[model samples]
Structures are given as structure tokens and as C-alpha cells.
Target: MSNFNIFLKQGTCSYCNNSIVIQRKHSGENLCPECFQKNIEKNIYKTISKYEMLKSKDRIIVALSGGKDSISLLYNLNIIQNRTHNSKPIIALIIDEGIKEYREKSIKKAKEFCNKYNIEYKIISFKDKIGKTLDEIINMKRETPDYKYACNYCATIRRRLLNDGAKELGGNILAMGHNLTDFAETYLMNILYKRLDIIANQYFFKEENDEINQFYIKKISPLIRIPEEEIFLYANIKKLDYYPSHCPYREKDPIIRKRVLDFIQECKKYSPEIEFNLLNGFLELSKTLYYHRKKKNHSLCQKCGYPCGNGKICSYCSYLLEFS
Candidate 1:
């Protein structure tokens, strides 16, 4: 037999002397199922501690979409909160964007998970808060001459709604489920677009004023160090009840973000550590940009009184106006 076949025949887990389940190419570790799951949890815990993402008194609102990443994050954070001394129970906040077949299925899975764990959860929809569902919004704007992609509208509205909803629920921190690949894609997109201001805004150690905190909850991503594929693996390995489909819009949209994501995924085949490198670059570059860039005083949106970044209207409001 060949050396490759021989190596596979003798492949035991690097962590435990058990049969290997998966080999992480980037780290060159052969891991059994149990050790792999444990390592993921430990890495999440370490990331939380390293970034000071949580405080004992802080109320956390997890952005749950019933997908693999969010479900995995909620599962881990639930365990952590239960063990912590005085942390408030994390709340799962689901955004119902009103996509007919898509959002309904995901929301069902989200509710089931929350019910199983007896976690407090809330559902807010674009229809109730923004006067129209995402589908309706798309139907209205799809034919407009200046129409943008569905993802752009969905992201802007979802972000504002999440922040407002979390604040309304008295949460001081909002935990997101974005993974390393997500961050890398976003970082590369912003770099390509030369959106340095956006990069600076992502600085983890940026000072928080009470005014900004009132409108925007402190956001953290405990899963930022994990990759998208690994989260998918962990979720499946743990038998998590997560939705196994991507948003239909994401699949069908002709957005540049999709191209950027494709580029990153393609690069990963050649460079296993490319995502981690981009993440590190984002961390350092964001910090440097945050400190060195000239501070632009935030101006409140005339309609909503939230910071508009020296503009008279925030992107959320501008989109709403366009929809009108």
C-alpha cells in the first residue's frame, strides 16, 4: 500500500489515542469527536476571557437565526452563563424578516431550541417594527432604477432592529454569531472598498460613551475565532437542532459581498490559515485606525436621534426613505 493509505490506516487522534474523526489541516491536529467538541468549547471560553466579552452583571442578548453558528454559540454561552456566578440568563433574540418559506422554518427551529433549553427568547419582525416585511420591501423596490441588493436592505434594517430590540429588552451586550470566515470576508470587502472608517468602528477596545451605549448595545462575537466550516461540523457533531439551509437571497443575490466570500473560500483551499491571517490583520488594523484617524463627531439622525456619523440621516433612515 502507499504511504498515504498507510498513514490513514494508522491515524489515531492526536489528543487521545482514539480513531481519528477529523484532521484540522491548518493546525495539523487529528482529533476524535469528543476532543474536537471539547476543544471548540474551550476555545470559545478562552476567546470570551481574552476579549473581556462578558461581565458578571451584564445582560446578554444573543442574535439567534436558528443557523449553525448562532445555535452553536447559544449552546456554549448557555453553559457558560449557568456556571458563572452572577451573570444574567442570556436571551435569544430572533429576527423574523418575513421571508415566506425561509424565515418560517428557521424561526420554528429557533423556538424549539429555546423551548428545549428553557431559555428566555423573543421574536421581533420587520413587519411589526418597520411597517413592512422583507419580502414586501423587496417586492416594492426590486424594479426601482436605483435599487440595491436585498442583502443590503436586509442587513441595514436587521442591524438597527437588533440594536433597538436588544436595548428595549434591557440587554447591555449583544452577542453575535459571526465566525472567522465572516469576519475575514467583511474585512477584505471593506479593505477593497477602502472603507477605513468602517474598519475603525470595529475596534474591540474603542471607548464607549453613555450616549452611544444607550442606542447601540456593546456587540461581541465569541465565535469570531472559529471558522464557518468548523462550526458546521461542531453543530452536526453535537446534534444541534439548527437550520441546515442558507438564506435564499444569499444564494441568489448578485452582490459583490457574495463574490468576496467566494474569493475567500477559494483562497482557503490553497492557504488553510488565510482566514486567521485576515482576522489578525483586521484586529491590528482596526486598532491602529481607531486611534490614528481623526475623530468625526457623531450627528444624531433627525428622525431617530441615533448617531449618523456626521450625516443628517443614518443608513437605516435613508433606506426607509428610499422604500417610501
Candidate 2:
């Protein structure tokens, strides 16, 4: 027996009798590269099905960022779409937050992937919509009192632009590439700050209403069950031409979200399934909160007609006013 085999007596894949290439710590399953990748795709399909995230006639808009998670998602979804009977081609929506060199590099990779696959794509920018680049926004607001982190501004602007852009492309469903780690981190952050309303807003199975649908595209994260590291591995294994760098603001910002993510990572060392636990907790809590919130009528923004809590203006419109 080889040294590797000797080290792991059960060195064969759990799904098949092939040499194991990766062992999933969460499930304690050893799998070969082929099987591992297959498992990831299978998980994605199952997540969509379990959540009822897609309908046959729904126009799909994939939010492609050219990063590992988003690229892997687009590749898998493309394959699935191709296999579906008489399904519409998925459109890729790329949002350029105008972070200078950072966003340009990713946009290049995003365009290349879309062109190579012959997928239709639309690119929107903060400059065109918000009237300023993120760099410019930060520079203008950094010294102001009550100035939020760059991530705060970027996320608000990007979310509005992505939703509007997707709707403009006539898409009813917006597919996101957020992985398990992202979900866990966000949920933890919300929990820390007692943001139950945000958690409630993310409930997976909300009945479709025309009023809400008109303003907000139905967003789905098919990769919600997959881990971040696994997505990175899958992207590399598939040899995807992805931009491997993160946004500069994400690393530089001393945001609580970053600390929460670090805490999650630290907990993962002792508890491999920590993220899964957090996700499950979120699922149950969000479901309960969703039904609870359903009793009250949602307050729509006076300007945009989107939900804005008790306020007359939504955060998106509020940010626009600030920029204006």
C-alpha cells in the first residue's frame, strides 16, 4: 500500500472505489475529485429544489462577480440551464462598484467568461447610477460625521443597482453566489446586534405577492449550503478563469462583519460544522419570524415603493439623497 493509503486505511472514496482527493469534514465523507465536484453540483440542485427557488418560466439573472464563488455558480447553472427542457438562457448581471483597479480586473474576467460561454450579460456601474465611484464616495464622505464604513456604502449601492439592473433585464429571479460561510457570518452579525427583522426578511419560503414582486426581484442563493473553502477548491479544480482577489475595502474596513467572520473561522477549528449549525439556526428562526411579520403590513418607501421598515424612505433612497 502507498504511504497515503497507509495513513488513511479507508482511503477510497465514500461514493465510489476511487482514490480519495478530499475529505469533507462536516459530513465526514471522503471523495475523489470527480465525486467531490459532482457532490457540490448535486447540493446546489437540491438546495434550489428544497427552497423552490426556480420556476420553469422564470427568467434567471445570475449575479456574476468574477470571483471564485460567483464564477463556480455561473458555470454550474449554465450546465443545468443547458440541460433543462426549453429553458431560457441565464443572463449574467455584473455590477461595477468602481473600486478602481480592483473592480476592473474582475470585470475583465467576468466579460471573458460570459463571452467564452456566449452568455448574455449586462454591466452597470455606481458612477452611472449613483453619480460617483466608490473611491470618490469614500473620499467625499470619509471625514463626515456619522460616516459609515466603505462596505456599508458599497453594499447599499450595489444591492439597489443589482436589483434594478436585474429587473431591467426582465429577470424575475436573481441568483446570488453567497456560500454557507457568508450566510453564517451575516446571520451571526445580525444576531449580535439583535437584528431579527433582517433575519426575518431572509426567510426562504415567502408566498409571492405582486406588490413586493414589483419592487424586489426574487433572490436565491443556490450555493447557500456549500462552504467557502469548498467553492474555492471547486473553482480551481474546474480550472475556472476567475479573479482570485477580494475587494480592497473588505480587507481594509474594520467592520464588525469582518470580526464576526473571523470569529466564525476561529470557531471552525474546534467545530467543523459550526457554519452549518448557524445556518440551520437561521433557517428555523427566520421561518418563525417571517410568519410572525406577515401579520403586519409592510411599510413601503414613499419614493420607491419598497419596504423601508417604519420609515418613509428606504435605505437605498436615503443613500441616494446623501450622495446627492
Candidate 3:
């Protein structure tokens, strides 16, 4: 037999003594393919149950980008839904940012995956909704004095699209594929910029009021506990047909989010549990901040009737005005 086959056959799983297929460095666990897959699925299930993320009556709108993290999340959610009694329907929502060569391929994969699994899906486009593709937005704003990065524009528009699409579809919960690394990186970015309002708004444990529920669908990230690399591995091992490429703008733009992610990865070299620590800190800090600000009344945006922090128009509407 070849050396690769010999290596695969030699080692046993740390938990089951079955032949190992994956060796996790941070956890120091050698797992067989079956065990690794099962462990990931179990973690996702536990995350949902622990956070009360889903209810039987909730219509879940999955933000499917056709990437590994999203593909894994959707697949696991389907499994969980299947095992439950009277499970709510899951609808895959895709936002086409209109990036040439990038979004087209991913959307194709997303449609194929949804079709193969018999899941209902909807597609909305930046051109249709915002009157501009991401490429056009970048070109239009690149030379402006207060020019925002491509990621900023992309995230802002995509978030609004997802929320509006889900709400229109009568979805009660919107599930995203933000993994552990993303959570950690975002937490650090908020801290660095001293954006306490953003942090408070993102507090996961806040009691939902009518004003909040009316506009914002409850958002959940069941993959938040799992690292990005692990999700990539899981998607590949499970033979999921997912888009392997990332957004072209992500690497090219000098965004702070990329820098923050790089910093977290560097810290992981010296301290393996740094990401977990950041996540824990975020949980505590967000809870404290939420309680501190919970009593403050939220004003509705004049244009969209969504909850706004201070201004009469919500940020989404404000951005829309800029494009108009």
C-alpha cells in the first residue's frame, strides 16, 4: 500500500479506537471520520438548544452563501429539523451582491445544493434592491472623501437585504454562518473602535421587546462555537458541494476586519484558547452592556419604521439615501 494509505490505516481514534481520519491540534483529539462528523453535528445542536435559538414554530431563514461555513450550517440544521417533531420549515435566502465572476459561481452552487436537498430558496440581488451592484458601488465611492471600504458597503447592504427578505418571507428567525473566528474577530474590532452602542445592540441575552421583535428577526449563529477551519474540514469530509472561493474584495481591501482576524490567528499561535477567551468575554460584556442600556427607549426610523439608535432614519435607510 502507498504511504498515505498506510498513515490513514495506522492511527486509532482518541475516543473510539476506530481508524483516525482527523487529528485536531487545539483539542488534541484524533477522531475517525464518523466521530469527527458526529462531534461537529452534536456541537451545533447543543449550541442551538443552549441558546434557545430555535423553536418548533419558528420559520428559519438560513443565510446561505454556498460557502463551507454556510453549507455546513444548513446541512446540520436540516438534520436537526428532520429529527424533531413538527419542525419549522427552513428557507435558504441568497443575496447576490453582483460581483462578477465570484457571486455567479457561488449562487449556482447554492441553487444546486438547495435543489438536491429539496429546500425552498429565494434569491434577491443588489441591482434589483439597491439599484447598483457591489462593483458599481465600489467604483462610485472609491474616490469620495468619506469612502468606505468594499466590505463595509457589502456587509451593510447584505445585512439589510437578508433581514428584509426574511421578514417578507414570514421567517421568525434568521440564521447566519458566523463561526468562532468571526465572533472573536468582531469582538476585538468593536473593542478596538470603542463601539459600545454596537456591542450593546449585539448583546445575545437581551430580553426581546415588541419594538425589537417587530423589525429585527431573531438572529442566531449555531456555528459560532465551531472554528472556521473545523467547518471547512467538516464540509469537505462530508462531500458537501460548496463554493471554495472567498469574496474577491475581502483580500484586496485594507479592511480592519481582515487585520483583526489576522491578529486573532497570530495570537492563536502563542495561545491556542485565545479565541474562546474572547468569545467568553464578549458574552459577559455584551450581557452587562445590554442590561445597562435595556431601559433606554428606541426610536423608529422615519423611512422604514425599523428601530434606530439615535437618528430618525435607521442606518440602512441612510445608506440607501446616499446611493439614491
lDDT of each: 0.88, 0.88, 0.87
For residues 26-45, what per-residue lDDT tens digits would candidate 1 score against the true structure? 89998887888899999999
lDDT of 1: 0.88
Assess candidate 1 and give its TM-score to the true structure: 0.95
Clashes in model 3: which pairs?
none
Task: Please give the range of 10 consecutive residues that has the lowest summed lDDT in model 1.
Answer: 1-10
lDDT of 3: 0.87
The TM-score values for the models, in the order shown, are 0.95, 0.95, 0.94
Q: Cα deviation in Å at residue 301, candidate 2?
A: 2.0
Candidate 3 segments exceeding 4 Å error: 1-11
Clashes of 3: 0
